[model samples]
Target: MHSLNDLLESFHLYAECERCQRSMQLSVEKLIARLGNDFPVTDLRPRLRCTGCNIRGQDLRIVFVGPPGKRMVFQYRR
Candidate 1:
């Protein structure tokens, strides 16, 4: 099980709306400040709401963005 604290360093968290397919990057620092560092990352799914469609369910994506100056590429398929 991964906590929010584990993601703070190298990983980037994103919330994607299942309905409208809207996606947004989340601030891990702000989240840790609010939800505490020990919060389970899996439990975050139900707590998220889509800003675009006002939906209650969200798909969480934990991406490895790597260190500075590293090349990163993301691919999405519908």
Candidate 2:
């Protein structure tokens, strides 16, 4: 069980909708600032909502994207 603090660096959080298959990047810093650093990563499953399909419960993906300027792939959104 990894906490938000554990993945603050060298990682990115993404929430994907099971129904519509839409994925969006979540801000770890914003989450930590709001939910605190000890917030469990697994606990975000039920809290996530899909903007595309308007459904509850999203599949969380923790991807290692490395530090800034290393490997830029997905764009982070709010």
Candidate 3:
């Protein structure tokens, strides 16, 4: 399984709030600062919150953005 560090280094982070459906893009550097480098990518849903609705982290859905015209190389389930 790929770790957060690996995902961040390889792809972009797309986070959506379950409440208001608000979305945000996060970069590897930013995520590292917020969640540390060793965190697992699959475990990020419970650690994100919607800035608009102020929803808790558990209600967030996280997706990985791969290169242009390419499907995600890594498989992560929500």
Candidate 4:
């Protein structure tokens, strides 16, 4: 069986922000706390019921651009 250490060394998981277009340090932190691992994390596509306060419109556009990279627009209208 592959030990955790060996597996970890082989492939690492990382997360990128779908917003600020950067490494989602904040979200990654939270995900790590909940999942227990944060190496091979996925991009964020956070969605929730329409904010009673209507913070955003029906949907939102989540963008991710880290390290002077291009933007990843996530136009979420849900």
TM-score of each: 0.84, 0.81, 0.65, 0.23
Candidate 4 or 1, higher TM-score:
1
On lDDT, the leading prediction is 2
TM-score order, best first, reads 1, 2, 3, 4
In model 3, where is the ten-residue run with the lowest total lDDT?
58-67
Give the winner by TM-score.
1
For model 2 the local lDDT of residue 34 reads 91
lDDT of 4 by residue, 1-78 (tens): 222222232322232433333332234334456545533322223322232342221222323332233333332221
- Candidate 4, residue 3: Cα displacement in angstroms equals 11
Candidate 3 global CA lDDT score: 0.67
Pairs of residues clashing in candidate 2: none
> Candidate 1 at 31: error in angstroms?
0.7
Segments of candidate 4 deviating more than 4 angstroms: 1-7, 24-78
Clashing pairs in 1: none
Each candidate: what lDDT? 0.84, 0.85, 0.67, 0.31
Candidates, ranked, lDDT? 2, 1, 3, 4
